[model samples]
Target: MSTYTVTSFASASPAFTETTYEVPRELPAFHVFVDILACGVCYTDLYRFDAVPGSICGHETVGTIKDVGPNVNHLKIGDIVGFGYLRSSCLDCHQCTSGCDIMCKERKLFSHGPGGFAHAVVWDSRFVYKIPSSLEPKYAAPLMCAGATVFAALYNNNVSPTARIGVIGIGGLGHLALQFCRAWGCQVVALSGSLSKKNEALSFGAHEFLNTKELTTETVKAQPKFDFILNTTTGDLPWDLYLSLLNPNGILCLVGFQEKPLEMKSNHFLYHQARVVGFLVASRGVSKKMLEFAARHNIKPMIEEYPMTAKGAANAMQNVRDGKVRYRAVLIVPQDSSKL
Candidate 1:
């Protein structure tokens, strides 16, 4: 095994730098070292750097396993795999045993544990998933996190192909949700704050594009109510407007967390029997199912790739923070074979 390894970190308040770190020559049971091919940069990574120092950040990663432990049978060396936000979960927990490992009380994020920013990482084999042969590694990385999260949220809500789905926030998550909803035979509406996203939304299979700023209770009431509205924004909406857009028994799923509380008129919900729910990245079980579903449907993220070197981390992080990334930013690590 090679003794040299590389890692990226927040060099200053908001900056990152690449530096070499040490690599273990062997593996322990339930552990495997993977040579990372791509690491996706998401908004949550920024939240970690807000008050801390020297935090290793990155969870969405796709790569090849270099070594495996004797106890691990489901995976083997040289297998192309991907791991999401979590690295460890207590198997005995209700959530884990029930296939909801994302909610396990003992869940530990790789960012908070040993993350995927390094050239090689030691991960629990149970948390790693083999990539579908049909998907490219670079595009598959973000799907492990963003893609899985949205897919799980919809699945958890029991969204059917006949459901009328509206996706709010046309950024990374919204784009993927639009495609998934469309592929499932649902009529999708892209709800955005800017008029600029109208064309982009339509191109992504949204049957309708409505500017949130221009929408009001009366205006929305005139249109057919959506069976489900997936809110992926960082701020609260005029809840009355969203609640009004729902048909009887419709749901509003909050996938994005805002700093402020959402304001709503209780009467609107009480009269319509509307419900509000929230979700995060799914458990390992759901992630696996989502991947299988995606593979069958040919649903994939629109990715912008970068190298795993210092320069690549900087460019991708900046694009993510500025919301300039087209959809998702995936960092590619040159394989050792590439160096040859």
Candidate 2:
């Protein structure tokens, strides 16, 4: 059997080092070998989650199938595919039988090894998705994770045209949230700490922009209160303050993590009859729907692109770490390989 060469970046505590691996030609029956075309760098790849030493950390991977196992009949070689953080789950669990296997306790993450940071990777056929050929490859990367995340926040919650939607942060996830909310026909309000993004947010389809620095209770009350506020901010925020902006029975969907716990007064949610709920990335089912929705609405994320070399991956990481990225950061595989 021939050995295949793959380039990968391994986390060595304070840093990432590029390394190459050689694997046997044989792969497990449920798996498929994918030649990666692009990978999106997410905050979770750098700060949120931990991966073992010498393992690749990327989860939003777009590629074309290079090989399929005997047990996998749903996919074939040369198929354009995208895979997210979910690697595998025990199919016998109740959640699996209920067709909501993303919530399975035995769910596995692709970050453990063979992540999309490499030129080639392997994943379970069940969790992989076929991307529309019409979609640009780089856009497909972030759609697998970030796009699916915010879309799920809106989709699962039953956000509607009449619902006033407020998006916080206006960065990686929030920007996409704003666009999706607008396309969904909801009146969108972009909330931020400063006014720097007001124009961009408006250009992205927000009907109104709220600069928190200049915000007042009277100003908030003057506008339509939010029926759904999607908080995509990644740090400690004035949770109670945002809660006050919600209409009665409104939902504040928390999709980002905070290092510190959020504290709120009892009456903050009680008096308004508001709810605070959070969600992880979507199930494979919802992800498919999000892809279709994005295509129909032309809801592509604003992204910064880099080459797919080791240096390129490192640059993407640095850009995300320094908060210099405009929006999503994607690493584009070289042309010779993307054609495959």
Q: What digit string (tens of lDDT, one per residue) describes model 2 on residues 256-332?
A: 88789879877966788889999889888888888888888888889999887767777888888888898999988
The true-versus-predicted C-alpha distance at residue 182 of model 2, in Å, is: 1.3
Candidate 2: worst 10 consecutive residues by lDDT?
Answer: 47-56
TM value for model 1: 0.94
Q: Write the per-residue lDDT of candidate 1 for residues 33-61, one digit (tens) a residue.
A: 78788888887777775555566678888
TM-score of every model versus the real structure: 0.94, 0.94
Q: Local error of candidate 1 at 120, Å?
A: 1.9
Lowest-lDDT window of 10 residues in candidate 1?
4-13
Candidate topping lDDT = 2
